[model samples]
Target: MVVQTESFVMLSIVLFVLGAMGVLLRRNAIMVFMSIELMLNAANLALVAFARYWGNETGQLFVFFVITVAAAEVAVGLALIVAIFRSKRSINIDELHEMKG
Candidate 1:
């Protein structure tokens, strides 16, 4: 059985909304980062679906670039989070008020 394009888009939207809510509601740095990743993945899903629907590779190509950037972001972001946790002994966003390092 074939899936509908609208259904795919709706699912993608649902995932993106959930991720956005997670980012807005969660206070932990790691949680916020994960939520952002989820949102990015949701966008990728929509892009793939639309690419398939339109019979083109442009969206897919964009997804590849997104994935690459996401990979780099994950590496750099986790490092920063780890460093912050090491120095501050916490990962809560509201607690991180100091900028001088």
Candidate 2:
């Protein structure tokens, strides 16, 4: 019932890469937001693994802060998405240029 640090780190890396790809390749705003969340979770996973290996609570504690910031980000991000969709009728990022003026 033991897990290897390398295994966890590798998993984290894979998840982060997948998230990054989604963000880079997708056009939908919601999809990109979910991808960002995925990346954050992957980072948190790695942090927890390292904290466990080091026999310390610091990583877990930092994860809590990350979670808090994520919550705030979600609130603000969703609000902005809604506002943009209301006016533009689409969540496509390419439409963002209209707001430049």
Candidates in order: C-alpha RMSD to true structure: 2.6, 1.9
Best candidate (score: TM-score): 2
What TM-score does structure 1 among the candidates reach?
A: 0.91
All models: lDDT? 0.95, 0.94
**Model 2, residue 57: what's the lDDT?**
100
Error of 1 at 71 (Å): 0.5
How do the residues 8-63 of candidate 2 rate in per-residue lDDT, one tens digit apiece? Answer: 99999999999999999999999999999999999999999999999899999989
Q: Which portions of model 2 show Cα errors greater than 4 Å?
A: 99-101
**On a 0 to 100 scale, what is the lDDT of residue 48 in model 2?**
96
lDDT of 1: 0.95
Where is model 2 poorest over a 10-residue stretch in terms of lDDT?
92-101
Per-residue lDDT over 1-101 for candidate 1, one digit per residue giving the tens place of the 0 to 100 score? 19988898999999999999999999999999999999999999999999999999999999999999999999999999999999999999989877856
* lDDT, candidate 2, at 37: 97
